[model samples]
Target: MGTFLGHLLPGSFFILYASWHMFSVFTKYFLSQRALATTRDQGGTGSSGGGGSPSTPYYRSTCAHVFPCCPRIPMEGIVKIVLTTIGFLGELITAFEDGVFVHYGNAQHMTMYFAFGLSGVFDIKVSRGPRPALPNLDYVALAMAFAMEALLFGYHLHGRTPLDVQVHMLMLYTIMLCAVATIVEMAYRRSVLPALMRAFFVMLQGTWFVQIGSILYEPLTSPWDENSHSQMMLATVLFCWHCMGIFLLMAFVGWLLNSRVKRMLGTSSVYCQLERRLEKGSATCQEALQLTEE
Candidate 1:
């Protein structure tokens, strides 16, 4: 994945994937919190719960809700499978040298995509198949996928410039964290923290991948000094910057979703109250009319 387009394409995919995960996680968390608050206001015992509530039930994202006839279709899994297949094919075509599979680096890249594609298949099976052998098998699949990714990237830096090696090494940290966080998420499927951490690391990795591409290729500016210690240190500092930026982005997304959810809940509450008041007024009018008839 050393080529300019190579890094950019995968990096772009990761950014979009991470953004989707973050959006789903934040929206569900906020919806659950809103439900709990409504329960409290209605004088019910509102315990801090981890799993989904009726107001925002847990289900893997699919287009089934939009098209009821296709309830069994796992859209997310399909997308993963299709896109990763295309990516895998692309790598295969490029890695070949006169009928020889000599590009070891591209082979490593292919494995990463293959792992994710297999995870997609697991998603489909779990969603469509009868009672999977293990509960949360999807999470396990995802965790393994991330672990595979980290393992491959860990060995991908051979015969590289000092700067390239340093930048990729920094990327390895995020990938390892992503694997760890995903494993934790499998255990705490209901809790938002682990999922949020996973999303954050994914986003960080995505942005860092793009950053690596820019630094090494200098598509927009002069090329970086691959041998300078100062340049290497700068890359490290820049990685920290990417972390802070992703954190802020996540925070903003969470806050924005929470506010919107609160507004929706408030609007629904007002509408319900209005209906109740109208019902009461209509009942009193009926009683008065009966008395007049008497």
Candidate 2:
């Protein structure tokens, strides 16, 4: 990475993607639970009306409202394509900036280019037109992304300052955790914990990049020549501060979303009716909510 700009640009994109992913996950879960509760209420009413008629299906679509311009298109897929293209372009530009292509003879750039480019292709395959029967391609792309990041860690390990090496080491661990979480999500589709953890790790990685840029750039607080015992201790403290900041941010986001969902449920007439039904000795709504929670 050249300087603060180099790291900040990509880090911003990753943070945006991570935020979007978290919002999508939370919204989808909330809406799907509401839909299930509504379906149960309808079914109960229909059953009491003498005829055993099937309840109308409530289709829960993905959150496309974030981009009002193209409600039909998946926002996540579009973001993936845009961010990955930006990443590829950034790498190409960096290569050109370094004079000759061979001058930078590092595999990190090339690996990242392939990782982002291939991920965009897979995102298109899974998201464009009709939804694919198998959307596991996205996770495969994620695994590739993680692999490329690990390769970058190898490049960082050779002839770097102690602080730089430590940062990269933490990045590698975060990326590995993200990859494992993605695999868990693929295997257990209903489990929300893995997906949430993956998003959290991605956010952590973005924050770490910001920390790296700060330490390498800003002259006043730069750890460029941090080799002394005291200097190293200060750097370690800075790292822990960054980690704590990110954790607090995550906690705030979680609380905000939880409050918003609870408010929506309270204001919803359908949800109110469902609650009344549940109070009147109906286990359907309760069971549906339990299933959705799991």
Candidate 3:
């Protein structure tokens, strides 16, 4: 995982998964709010618009939709399994050279991918199985995946230079936070904030992976001096920048999606009111005509 492509591939995978999770969380939330608003407008007292109950079909924690056409299908889980399987196989092939355990770094990577791939399988099982498991098996599996990642990364930097080790340590912090957040999500599946936090940290990990690759391997620029104090300082600052950038991105996406959902619900409400008024007017006119004929 020292090469530019090595980091970039996993980085891209994390970014893709995190982005899709962000989109799914935002869309499901506002859409559920729209449903609640519609129920209110129609004068029906509905359940709270919080994350769906475990008894129902879906919730924020289980927001995994890969295809818009097949919304009900567990495509996200399927995709996760497929992608992680590829990553796992690639790592396996790299780790074993002529049936020998030559590259332990690749072996480390293989474990990380295996954990996430197993989580994906659990997600599919919970999603399609008879009933939604209490305490959320999906969240449990996800938390385990993040924990495994944090564990692997914590031990991955034994022989690296100070700068390289420092950069990876920062990444370890993010992975730990992701693990903690996923655990919180497991406990409180109704709260949308924990799910959002998980996605945020996941994206941070993605971007930071790219940053580490560039710093350590000089993929696109001159090699950063591993012993320079200033280079390490710069890495810390850059990590902060990545955090801020991801936060703003999530906020903007949420706001935009919320506005669109509101507009859609607003238009529907207007149409319903108009239809009701027209019906009332038609009934009044027919009664007047009947009275005149009598």
Candidate 4:
């Protein structure tokens, strides 16, 4: 799995972030009250009958879509729609540019993760599990992930020719995205604020992966280059592991968000079971209180 995924690290990161973005819209709408949801504009896609296209076609397409059958579509959908569109645009944008970063150095990569460590403390919102704060384990995991992004870039720079400048720059962006995601993960662990902010960033990471695959398997470059063949391979291995970690992190966040929304809604039968358990505990406490009185 690592071998195949090693070929696809950055791509996994972007896709997972996109998936997270997709879910957040549903989450907000699902959690809203009916009357308030109705009063708000449905999506900006002519659903409100403002101007552009006819309301019937927009509603037709929207109704044609699923998931928001009961609640209105989130206005946030407009932003998400735009983000997803832009994420794809990165591929084209990178293609037009020289496709390499100018100037690379070890010092530059280290600052990336430092930013993440700092950001985590500020963007705290907990939308997951029983806790109001992100789990301690999440901080540990994020710090570790941040280290991996930096370390890999360190190796990449160490092997560079002056020509690798643009490539290093892309690596820098990957480092920055991972750094932001790591901090966001910490903040997320603290409380599920807006993973959506760093969510679109996965695309730039995917650009890294596709580039790696080109070097390894693509006809353009050899898997082994002279300056740091062995070290580069090690970087590849780490890159793949990091991507898997990235995917798992996204999935875990999704699970955390799901659990949180479930608990918030209290609609699930399992939630009822938990409520009953809580009531039983309350009764036990009350009996103890009565016995003390007696």
- lDDT at 57, model 4: 14
lDDT tens per residue, model 2, 218-247? 635634664566656776787677668766
Q: What is the C-alpha lDDT of each candidate?
A: 0.70, 0.60, 0.72, 0.40
Rank by lDDT, highest first: 3, 1, 2, 4
Candidate 4 residue 48 C-alpha distance from true site, Å:
31
**Candidates ranked, most accurate by TM-score first:** 3, 1, 2, 4
TM-score (C-alpha) between model 2 and the true structure: 0.74
TM-score of 3: 0.83
After superposition, candidate 3 runs with Cα above 4 Å error: 47-60, 132-134, 265-294
Across residues 17-128, which tens digit of lDDT does each residue of candidate 1 receive? 8887787666645654564566557654333234421221222221111112233366667878998999999999999889998888888889999999988887777666
Span of ten consecutive residues with least summed lDDT in model 2? 56-65
Tell how far residue 210 is off in model 4, in angstroms. Answer: 0.9
* Cα lDDT for residue 189, candidate 3: 64
lDDT of 4: 0.40
**lDDT of candidate 2?**
0.60
The TM-score of predicted model 4 comes to: 0.36
**TM-score pick, better of 1 and 3:** 3
